[model samples]
Structures are given as structure tokens and as C-alpha cells.
Target: MPSQPDSSQLNNGSSAHRTLSGGGEMGALMRTIDWAKTPVGPVEKWPHSLKTAVRILLDCRLPMYIAWGKEFTQFYNDAYRSIVGNKHPAAMGISAQETWPEIWSTIGPMWVEVWQGQSFGFDNFKLTIERFGYPEDCYFDFSYSPVPDDTGNVAGVLVTFTETTEKVLLQQRLQASADQLTRIFEHAPVGIALLSGPELVYEFVNEPYLELVDHRPVIGKPLRVALPELAGQGIYESLAQAYETGQPYIGRPQMLLKRGQPPTLQHCAFEVVYQPLPDQQGQTESIVVIGFEVTELVKAQREAELANRAKDEFLAMLGHELRNPLAPILTALNLMQLRGTSEVERERTIIERQVRHLVALVDDLLDVSRLARGKLTLKKQRIELAEIIAEAVEQCSPLLEQRHHQLELQVPNTGLTVEADPRRLTQVIANLLNNAAKYTEPGGKVTILGERLDDEVLLWVRDNGSGIEPELLPKIFDLFYQEQQSMERSQGGLGLGLAIVKNLVGLHGGRVTAASAGKGRGSEFSVWLPFALATQAEETLEVIPNLSQPGQLRILIVDDNMDGAEMLATSLSLYGHTIQVAHDGLEGLKAAQSFLPDVAILDIGLPTINGYELARRIRQLPELQKIRLLAVSGYGQQEDRERSLEAGFDLHLVKPVDFVDLNTALFEEQP
Candidate 1:
């Protein structure tokens, strides 16, 4: 049997509790059992509400600590028990810092607040610990409330919490999603922005939108500070309408502003979608406005429309201006040729030249269209500067002789070479010289000079002629612009000569300039061209020559037009080749076999069998295969030459061919 415990130690234990019991209806009930002498034990005998409350607090999903003097206790519900593992019971009955030292720094202050009877709570609190010997960082929402004694003083703290790891992480994830979407909106191309509030403050602006005026992060700024150009444009009023009605407003492409010297005008198109931001109660708090800009595509479309209109007008005027003078001049030349040795022959030659000038003018107008559409291409080769200059001088010889001008030529004997399209370069130089001769008085001096300078070759045509006026010199290269009031205009050109010269030179990666000591003193036009370096220079010159020996060998001439074939065949027979003329390629092939001609002249456009196909068939005949095949056609582009070579022709010549060049080609040796 056990001895009785001391009564004085029991009386001291529950003195305060007995005092409260005396004032209540349970005071008489406590006296019979000596309430002051009750022993301290586990809280299993607490009232239902107290037990349920403590149970609820202990059952929380967060790790908790409660301390009463020296007796410290820790509890982890199902959620937090996993964190401590085998250390659960040992983790209990210890100070929070001793059990989870890593989290004690933050937990210490929260415990003080709870013990002092102040309620405390925190959301998304980070808890890092190694309680069970593994490190972890977790999120939690925690709260502490005091558990008061019957005397109304706090005796213990009720730590209540939820392991808000998922909730805290989920909330942070939502914020991160919002931030990412905001970044995309703020940097999108073509001026994206948001407008908010009644004052139209800019809530956000993207990188591109800010670059429209060179700023950074246009957040928290008034719209007017950046774009005062919007005044009276009704933008703000429209935004007010959108904000008030919760409906979107759209803006079509319109003029925005102008800036820069030579001041460029800006145009923009935009549409805004207005949205109402709401609270949890669904009440509107603010408005969101979105904007988008489109300008370049609209400008391109408008320019294309204008160019189409200009081309149509240019073609119509060109036809009327060119064809009107050709009829009488052709008729007079025909009559003069019939009376071979007459004074009328001289007059007819003048008429013929004037008619050719008109034809050239029409050709230039069409060429402008071709150049604009990227259709103009060149036939380039390494050529002698002297040869090119001589050709140009010869072409302008009649004009020089007509004006009685003393034309001089100066070029290096060793040959300064230029990479160029030969025929085009000849035309360019001839136009300059002819214009000088036309404007100069009789007996005026004209000189053509070529000199190598550094890596380039420069050619100059200078004349003691009536020069360009100072006012018109700037526009001399412009199409159809002439200095009509000056002596330079007496030449009566449509002003296309210099314009074509400039374009042709540019195509060869060269440049040209026209200069004069004011009007009438003199004028000089200089062309600068890149010359081939010695390493890449051509070694041999190509010459096309007529037969040097007298030729009575049989020749076959094929053309689609009867007159064209007969006339060419007759000319060849006079030059002493046994000639056979055929209007179609099929007949020409038959004549070629019968005559077994030494040479064949074929037109590319022929009925029944095309010249290319007939040439292929002729090559198949062993007897006629060795005979030369020359393609003659009005199609003279670079592509035409390539096609002719592919179709087995030895040479390709454009129509209305130069008789001298043809003669040279017919007789020239292959080597």
C-alpha cells in the first residue's frame, strides 16, 4: 500500500482555480472534492468544447509548438508529420528552436506575440528546416491565439495553421503568369499601348511604341506628354466613350505627325479594345485600352497606284509625237533613191536623219518603262576605248560635217580598256557629240579625249559650243526636261539624250557629269568608268569582218518576209555569192541542200519550221552540217543572244543591220 501525498503541495497547485470555482455555481460541488488539491495530468478530462478546440488546433496541417514554463510540446498533424518522419515523438516536448533550429529565427518572434496574448497571423511564410535531417523550404499560412485560464489571463497559446505550400506556390505562380503576359504586351511591334483613367494617362507602352519618340518604359506618363499631335483628333473623346460604354472603339489609318528635315510625315492605323477591370464583388474599378500601328504597307500601295497612272499617260503621248513625222520623210527618201544622182538626194538625206531622230525619241520613252520594271540588261565585254570613241565619232560625223566642226580625238595608243556594253556605250557618246554639234555654230571645235586615271578610265567630250544655262544644268539629267530658253535647246531634242546617257553609264557601274562656264562659252561632258586590272584584262580583241577574198560561193538567205529576203539575197549576189532566197525556214532548208551553200543566213521567226529548229535539222545533214548558220532577227536582247547560241547558230544579228559589220562578219577568220 502507498502512503498519502502531501495536502499543502496540492493546495498551492489549484489556489487560483479554486478561487474561480467559489464564485461560480460549481463552488459547493468543488468543496466536497477539495478542488485546490487536484493533481496535474494529461488534458484528457477537459470539457467537450475545450477538448474539441484543442483537438482542432492540434489537428492542423502545420508543425506547431506550445510551451508552458519548462514543459514544451510539439505536434505535427498528418500534413507536417511527413516532414519529421521517425523523429516525430522526439521532436515533440522540445523547444521549437531546438527541434527545428533552421526556422527558429522567424518562429521566435511569432511565439512571443502569441504568449503575450496578441493574435498573430502570416500568409506565404517560408519555413526552411532540417528537422528530420533533410533540408526543405516550404510555404505556410500560420496563426496563433491565446488560451486563457478561468482568471482571464493567458496560460497557453493555441497555434493554429495550415500548410499552405500549394496555396502559396499557386498564388506566386499566378503572379508570375501575369508578369510574363505583361512583358509580351509591352514589347510587341507596331506600337502597342494601354490607356487608362479619365485623364487618358498611358498605363503601358511597348518598346516599339516608345521608339516612335525615343523613350524608355512609358509607364505612368500622360499620353499628351509624348504625343501632343493627337490634339483635336478626338482620340480622348473616343476613349471616354469606350470607357463609359464598355464597348471598343477602332481607328482606321490616318495621318499622325511629321518630323525630320525634308520633314517626313507619319501615318498610322489603330484599333482599341476597352475592358472593365472588376473587384471580387464584380464592381468596375478601372478600364484597359489596347492599341496597334500600320503605316509602311499603306504607303507602298498608294505609290504603286500613282506609277501605273503615269505609265499609261506617257505611252499615249509618245505614239502621237513619234509617228506624225515619219510618213512624208519615208516617201521623200524613196523618191530620192529612185533618182540616184540628184540635188534631191542631199535634201532626202536630211529628211532621213530627222526621221531617225524622232524614232529614237519614242524608243527612249519606252526604255524608261523598261528600266523601271528591271527589264533593261546589258551585253558586257572588255573593249578598246579608242575603238569605242572612233565608232561614236563616225556616227556623229555627218552632224559634224554639216556644222563644219573641227572634231579631234585623243586616246592612248597602248589602249585604255573599259568593261562595257559596246553598242550602248557608243550610243551614249554619240548623243553627247551630236548634241554639241547641233548647238555649236559652224567651224566650232569639238574634241573627244580618253585618259586612264588611277583604277578608272575617263572619257570626255568637250565643245566650244553654246552651253547649258546655269539654271537648267541641275535638271539636265531629268527625263523630258530641256533648257528651251537657251541655245542648247536649239538642237531641238526632247531632252532624252542626256537622261539616257546618265542611265546607261550608271548601269555599267560608271558615273557622268556635264559642266560649262555658263551658257555659250563652252561645255564639257565627262564619263568615268571602272577599268579592268592588269591581272583580269582581256588578251585578245574580237573582230567581225566581211570576207576579204571575193566570194562566189553559194549562199542561202531565209526570212519570213519576201521583200526582206529578196533584197538581202540580191545585195549578196551583187557582192558575188551565188544567192538563194526563201521566205520560210522549210523552203530554205530544201534550198540549202540543193545549193549546198557555203553559208546560211536565217531569220529566227519563220513559218512552218522555226529558224532554230531548221538549223538543228540542217546540222543533222552531214553534207550541209559544215556550213555556217547566222541568226538574223529584230530581237536583240542579251537573252536573245543566249538563245541563239543554244540553238546552234554561229552568230546573232539584230535587224536593219549595219552592212559594213555584216560584211566583216561574213569574211572574218575564226582565229
Candidate 2:
């Protein structure tokens, strides 16, 4: 430390300095001070050097504060007033410790150095200063230089500073936001890329985007340079268009070719969109590309289409081949009814029942074909639902008995009516019952319940059987979807029954749904149909007797199939009728004219001519004008029936013709 200075250097001689008053803000503050109460005492009695330093501080336009004497009293110009907002005049006369006590620990050392004649200068120095009764972090570019007295000894420290708190804080906030954005770019699930310049140079690529390009190096390179394989692909052109015209482009499942390890082009399908980014002048500057890879999904869809087509072709062929022999087998059954003994008749009944089931399976396949082509037509009418239920129960009775299912029927006897096709409605309920009976174990309970709601009729078929798998339940009604059959030597079905049920219900503006708790827990299927109210006029219905009247007739049968023709002829002959058979259309036509037959039954497929052409030829024969013509065919589509009617046939019978229906047509003549 230096030796103590002379009294003249500390306080200068009393009354030796002039008053420091001026036109500036600090000058105005000095003019209003009560110098007698301050440590510096009255202005006239202050030291000359202290007075000189105060005058220089007040005259300067820069922000300067003075801590004088031992207390380091706080003093500043108007510019520093805004920095220490709201702490103005009260802070003016206080010591540096009292005015900024919270920050004194940081700045107090600097002041001690200045007072010792050692100067200090700091930039961007941080401190927590208590200015508004609370501590706030702030920064400053300041100096703590010694202020010398007249004898060249330090008397005070001079402070010159500029608060850069706001500027520094703004920069920090901007940097934090940038860091946050970088995190989002790196972790986004979908592919994202940012490109800049006319050539669409890659400025950034995220993790997902890197995977899309096989992790190729693309940053800072033009898109074409990065992926030369995409040159002729539409993607490059689309990108250029959006970049140049500033018009966005979106591509869905567009293929992009990239080279792989084997140098072969690997195609990736992506739903990508190119969005233009504009600069301040509203001109295109960059582009943002966002996309989702859909390659697997697209491939799966294409494969599914091919599979469905294969299934459809298989169904058509299966249905056709199955129907061919059904006609002969059915004819044989009818023949056995009259010739066979009681024991043979019982076996004949079994064969007849099985043949009918096989025909139903074939019919269902044909129905599915019609459904796929959207060519099915419904024959809707108003009828009592109870009548349909009775018919369905009768149809499913054999299967129910075979399975030994305890059947329970819950239905209203009358007044429960619906507008529906009688045949289709009966088929729907019958199918549900059949499926239930087939799937149920012996002694399992099967229930058919019906309830009428406000405007809909709900029919449910429930079974306590080997329940469906949970995963299979959702797709139970889909075409050709069958659950795993148990190991009981049972070929339950071809999986078309429920699909037909769904389609039939849909045609009637209704819906069908299946529910199951899981395997071995049971399943229930519900069909909801719009119901109708029965009027008094509809309450009374006509009763038609099912019995056939006995008649003897001269019949001519034509068919290409020998077994079908011979069996049918024998069955009709047992009805006290004279019958002749011809294997060809021409032979049958000649026989019909010669015999002058009462009825002519013709098969469509003949050797030299079709049944249609034969029917036209037979109609032209004036001698055969009185003969009733019945056309037989395997196809029962509406178009087949119409063609038969147009060919001069009075009635069209489907192949494997029901004997009862055929007898009724023969004996009960058209009105």
C-alpha cells in the first residue's frame, strides 16, 4: 500500500473548489442534493479534486457512475437511470453496498481495486442485481477505472457501462428454439427432407428419410446427383415443377427406384408431397418433402386381387362340374321310389337326401358367382315371417336329427310379418339352422329365436357348440372363410353358407352379424330385417293342396345323358303313363310328331342341336302344336328361364328336377 496521502488530496482544502452545476441530468441532480447531510458535506466545503471529477461525470454524454470516498456512494447520469428502472432518486445518495446489496459481493472487489489505483475493465459481465426489490440477472460492458485526486492519489472509481441484457437474452432464446427444432427433425417417424436452390439441393435429411434412400449420402448435393436412378421417374419432374412454379404437388403410392447392394433397382412406393417454401420476396426458395412408405400395403393389395380372381374361377368350374351328374342321380332316386322294396327304399331315401345336399352346395357356389358379378335379382313379397320359419325348420330337420341337437324354437305364431322374398328368406334361416346343426356336437342345444322391434324383425340362431376362434369371428361371414373343423370325420361345408346369408340379408336392406366368446364357448348369429304390418286383407291367405292329381299321358323325353333320360322315363312310366325316350333333339322331334305326344320334356344339351333350337323346330311342326313343352336345364339364372320361355316352352324346370314339382306341372295344366 502507498503511504497515506496529504489532506489536500483527500478533501482538498475547504472552500477551494467551485460548485458543479450544469444543464444536464446529473447536473440537475447535483443542484438538488443536500450536501450538508452527505459524507461529502456542503459543496462549498468539498475537496477540489472531488468537485472536478463530479463536474466531468455530469458533462459526459456516456453512462458513467461514481462511487466516491470510503462508502463508494452511488451516483450516475440519466442514461443509467433506465437501466436500474424505478430505483432513481432514492438510490442516488446511497452507498454502493446499500443501493445494490444483492450484487455488492460481485462488484465490491472491483471497486477496491480501483480505489487502490489499480484499474479494471470487463465485458459482458453477469450479475444478479436487486433493482426492483427482486434479483434479476443482467449483463453489462463496463469499466472500473481509478479517479485520481489533485495529488495523483486514487479517491474514487469511475464506472462507464451499457446494459446488454435484452440483446443477450434474445440470442439465447433463438438458440434454444433452434435446438428444439433439430430434435424434431431427427426423430420424426415419416420421411422428411429439406431442399434448397434451383437444383433442389438436399439441405437436411432425417433418420426415416435416410432409410428411404438406403442410407445414402445426400446432404449438400442436388437431388438428381444424390439419386441419379430417379432421373426418368416422375418424382424428379414433380419436384422440379413445384420448386420452379411454387405450386405444391402430391403423389400417392408413387414408385421410386433406388439402387441396392446387387445394383438392381429397388422400387419403393411412397405417398409423397412437395411443398414450396417462399422467401421474403414471395419467390420460391426451397421445398419441403414429406412422405409415408406404402410399398408393403400396395403389394399386399395387388396380391389379394389376384387371389380373389383365382377363387372366383375355381368356384365357377366347381359349380359347373358338380351339376352335371346331379340330374342323373336325382332321376335315379325318383325311379327307385316306385320299384324298390321297403329296405331298398330306405337306402334310396338316404341317397336321395345326400344328393340333394350336394346339389345345394353346387347352388351356393353358383349364387356366389352371381353375387360377385352383381347379377342377382330378388323376388320380394309380403308374407308372415312365421311361415318362413316353419319352412326353414322343416328343411333343417334332417341335419338337426343327425347331430342330435336339442332344438328350441321361440317365435310368435302370427302377426309377425316382413316384406321379403319367400324362397331367399327361407334359405337364409335354413342356412343358419343347418350351420348350427352341423357345427354343434351331439346333445348340444340349438335355439332359433325371433323378436319384433319397433320397425325391425330380429331372428337369432344360437348354438352351444365348438365355438369360433376369436380371431376368426371377425371374418366368419366373409366368402370362403371357414373355421377349423373338429376331428369327427365331418366335412362340415365349403364355407359359403354364411356369406350367402349375409348377401341375402343385405338385399332385403338388413344386416347380419355373428358373435362368439371364443373357442368352445358357443356362438350366435343375428339377422335384422325391416318388418311390415299385416293388414286385415292380408290376414286371410289362400290354401293350395300339395297333392297331385293322377293322370295318364303320352310323354316324349329328350336328353343327351342316357342314365338321366332312361331313369326319368321309367319313373314317369310308373305313373300309369306311356313314355318314349330319344337321345338327340332331332330324334325326339321326329318321335314327338309321330307319337303326337301329350307332353314333351326336353334337355337343353343335345347331340346335333341345343334344346333351345329343338324347341323352335318342334314348335314349327303343326302336328305337335297341342303338345305341352317343358324345358329342363341345369342353369336356373333369370336369363336361362327367360330364354326357355321365349323358345315356346310353357315351363322351365331346373335340372335334377323335383319329382313333386314335375308331377304337378304334368297333371295340373296351365290355366
Candidate 3:
């Protein structure tokens, strides 16, 4: 039978071991085991070294155990019992194989080595254990050193250990998270960079950041040294400021210098953010850069600006060319209507009407340009709605008669009054009316009706024309939108009439809506205009009586177009006035000094000396000090009118003006 061999080197007999049978729970359980039947048998007669090792194991706060003699019997302290959990008191004096059967197969060889006087050590040693009902993964750091007998041969093993599963698991999860964050940083689409230390040394930069910096190597070097080209740029200073202040900086469409190949420009744009990264103690330790390239967006905006300016110049030249011919035709018509025979007057009427129509189209195109640029202004005033309705009807009646459409009008005797731009209101109503007539078949019935409801006046133009498609009703007022898909339509238009009407109404704080059941069914376009507070209604004259009268006032006409100037002089001469004409500004100034004309009609854009300078020169002469100056131009912008006033003109007139309006302008009253 095996009695416990001496482990004298590990433990000498002490008063502590002599009392071990009832020292603690493990000790109490050990005494209950029948030790004499085991390999390390007979507890009362056990060797002094064995008793000493057991005593020392039971006193430790750290998990420790002693396996004595050839049986490798288990003797463990209270802390070791907790490590084994519910396998506790029953495991106290059990053989190592019996108490730790789950891991005994793996640790048995190591146990044999320790008994043979060899030591075993493990750090974070893994073992699958079934101490509880289910198996669990456990880790430990432990040492199994040989305990020698009094005969000088190894007789037992002493073990000291710690469970390290929780710490190891936590470290694994932290590493996984770090790897995932690193992957995300590498693939991010925007440029990201990190700079550490007060000297602004570059620490990490993603691929996009490298590309933004012209793919120059920058890691582990200060920004100024790495990108020597950035020495004078403000970007380095911005980064430094963010670090020193601990405040973030954001730049939108900020200019940056990226030196390109020799011929290309050095300017680039970016939207960038710089933020400070703080340390655990709350001091800023680094600067992080986040940004995207905005060079394309900046370039696109500048290109658009250039194109718009070019369009404006083209429009100005186009307006001048169109008005030059129209002026001569209008002046010729005035002479024909006053002095020609019946046949001549009839033909002239047709020419005059068509020329005026072309002028209206040109004016509409110009208005569209102004509307798109947000340059149109409304001349708002208090006015009667009924008068505007009647005038707008008269304006559209020619198209209505030509198309052979029947118009039904509904109005109240007491006029609906509103404060608005009367001219724009008239244009709005007339555009709707003309639009109705243009789309309608000959003899289609159209109804134009207006009524007041609460604070609004609703004007409805319902036409039995080819109606709009239901899907297209909402877009009728959009600029350049047309109901017809065919580019060529019999009813000629630039698709601007309704768009202008919409813009004008909106400017007056109102809206326009179009309703149609479907294609081939009639459409209704309605405008809702707000009614202003009523004041005294003044009776407005709806017609202009021909006010031309024979007179002998001397006049001078200066224009670059010879036909326009001579025809206009001829028309003035028909009224018994002596008219002198000059084809250029220099000739006109000479004529003004010689003829001593009472009135001078000047066209802007004359060669040799433009009209503005001529006016100034004419003003300086004592012979023409009191002469009335009338400025005429195809440029009808507000600035054009202001410039005319500054040039000492008494009045300004747009081209293709009615002869009657010209008469009134020349006399400052009815001629």
C-alpha cells in the first residue's frame, strides 16, 4: 500500500499542519476521506513534508493545490475550490484523475513529468472543463513544480494558478474592433488625414488624402517639409490654428493651390473640415482633416456665369438689328395713311399691322429674358379692372376676328378696383385671350368672364379650342413649355405668352391655374388676382382720338439708318413742319447748329459720335439750349431710360412707337 512520501523540501512540519484536519472546509472534507485505502494512505501517519505542503496550500488566498505521492492525490485550498466551483468538498482528497477527469487526459503527461522532478509552466493555458453540468472554456496561468521527498527524490507536485478567461476574451474583442475601424478608414471616399504633435507631423493619411496632396509622400513628416509647395499656402496655418485653439474649422469652396503641369492653372477648390483630437487628459493632441474636392462644381458655376453674359450681349445686338428696319416701315406708314390714295392706304395698313405684330413678338422675347433674370419690375397703382378688361379685349380682338372666334364677355357695371400695375394686368388678360384664339379652330366659342369673390377677382378664359392634356395642365405656365409637341405649328409662337402671364400675376401676389378634362376637350385658364382697398374710382378714357395737327415747328432727326431718319423727317414735314435729317450724329449736330430746330429726335447707337455725346455737344451750343431732346432706342431696359435722362434728353421712347405718341412727345402735349 502507498503511504504519503516525504515532501520535506516543500513543507517542514509546523504547528499549522498539526491542526489541519478541521482547519477549514477543504481540511474538514480531507479528514472524512479514508486516506489509508488510497495510494497516499493513512492520514494520521502521513509524512511530515506532505502535511506541511497541505498546510501551506490551505492558507493561500490565490488558487493553489498539492498532489502528494505516486497517486497524485488532490489537495486544494478554499480559493482552488472556488475555481472548480460545485466540484468542491467532494474533490478535496480525490485523486487528480478522478476530480479533474475532463482535463486529466491532457494534463496527465504534464503531471507525470512534475512527479519525475521536472517542472511545468503555462501562460493562459486553455482547457475544456465539465466541473459544472455543461462544458465551459477556461484559461489559466500556472506552474507545477516538483516537491522533493526527504530521500532527495521528487515525491509530489505543488501548483499555483490564476483563471484568466475574462481578461483574454476582452482583449480579443478589442483587437477585432480595432481591425474593423482600420478597414473603414482605409476605404472611406472622402479624404481623411491625421497630424500629431505641436509641430504638425503627419501620422496617417488615406489614399484620397494622398491624391489631394498631389500623391506626395507625407507620412511621419511635418506638413511644410513633406509638401514643400505648401510653404506659402494658408492651409498649414489653418491646421496649426485648429490645434492651438482646440476649435474646429470648416471651409466651403475654399481655394487651394495645386501646382499642375506647366500650362494648366494652379488653382483648385475643396470643401474641408479640420478638427482637434483630444487626449485622455482633455488636451488636444492632434488635428484631423476631412474634405472633398469641389473644383468641378466651382468651374461649372463660372462657366454658367460666362454663358449668361454672352447671351445678354447677343440679345442686345439682336434687338438693335430688329428695330432698325421696323422704324423706317412705321414712319413710311404714317406718311401713307395721311397723304396716299385709298388703295395705297389699304396696303399700307396691312404692312403697318404686320410690322407692329413683329415688334410685339420681339418685345415679348426681351421680356422673357428679363423675367428669367428676375429683372422685371411692376409699376403698381390703383386701377379699375373693367377698363383693363376692355382694353385687353380690344388688343386681342384682331386675332379673334382673324381666327373667326366668337367671344362672350361678362363684367359688372361697377368696376372691380385693385391696386396693380395696370399695363401688366392688361398684358396678362390679353395674353390669355390671344392664347385662346390662337389654339381654337375658326368659329370656336370663347368666354372671358371676371367676377369678385371676397378679396379676390377671378378672371376666367374658357376656350373650345384643342384643350391641353390633363397631364400637361400643371406645366402650362412653365417657361418654354408648349402644349404641342411638333416644333412646327401653324399657330406661330415662342411659347412665352402664358409664361409671362404667370410671372406677372405672381409678382402681384396671385396665381394662375389651367384646367382641362383631357385632350380634344376645351381648356380653361384662370387667374386669381387680389383686390386692394377701394378708393375713389376715376373715369378712364378707353380710346385715344387722333391728335395729329398741322404745325410749323422746326425739327431735326438723327439716326444711323438713313431710311429710318429720312422717312421720319418726311412724316414730320407732312404736318407743315420743316424737318432736317442726318444719317449720323456728327451730321445731326452740324444740322442742329444751322437749322436751329425747335426739337431734335436722336437715335442712340450712331457711329462717329454716339447719340449721348451728341446730346451733350448739342446742349453746349447757345443755339440749341432751349431745344427739346427726344431719345429713341431699341434697348428698353430701366438702365437705358436712366442713362437717357443723364444725357439731357427731355423724353425717352422705345422703337416702333405709334406716330400719335411721338406727336404727343414732340409737343409735350397733344400735337
| Per-prediction TM-score | 0.53, 0.59, 0.77
How would you encode candidate 2's per-residue C-alpha lDDT over 210-274 as one tens digit per residue? 98887899999999899888878887888989988999998978677777677679887879989
Residue 274 C-alpha lDDT in model 3: 93
Candidate 3 Cα outliers beyond 4 Å, as residue runs = 1-177, 231-233, 241-250, 260-265, 275-284, 292-297, 413-419, 452-456, 485-488, 531-556, 573-600, 612-629, 642-652, 667-671
**Which prediction has the highest TM-score against the true structure?**
3
Q: Which lDDT tens digits does candidate 3 get at residues 1-671?
A: 12343445113434333637444777655544556667775655677777777777867778998887777788887778767777776666667787788988888899888877889889999988875688888889999999887677788889998989898888778988967876776799999888899888988899988878777779999877887666666888888889989999998797777756553447788899999999998889998889889899999988998898778767766877898889888988887877766777768878988898898888887888778788789878777688888999999888899888989988774657777887889999999898889888899999988888899988899998889887788788888788765566778777888899989999999999999887778889888989877657654544545455645799999988888888888887777888888878889989999999999999999989989899989999987789999998888866787888899998889887678788777867321
Report the error of model 1 at residue 571, Å: 2.1
Candidate 2 residue spans exceeding 4 A from truth: 1-174, 187-190, 196-201, 214-252, 259-266, 273-287, 292-297, 335-343, 361-381, 397-414, 432-451, 458-527, 533-671
Decreasing lDDT order of the candidates: 3, 2, 1
lDDT of 1 at 653: 73
RMSD of each: 17.6, 9.4, 6.2
Ranking by TM-score: 3, 2, 1
What's the distance in Å from true for residue 632, model 3? 2.0
TM-score of 1: 0.53
TM-score, cand. 2? 0.59
Name the lDDT of candidate 2. 0.81
Query: In model 1, which residue pairs have backbone atoms overlapping below 3 Å?
Result: 186-206, 545-664, 545-665, 546-663, 546-664, 546-667, 547-667
Q: What is each predicted model's overall lDDT from 0 to 1? A: 0.66, 0.81, 0.81
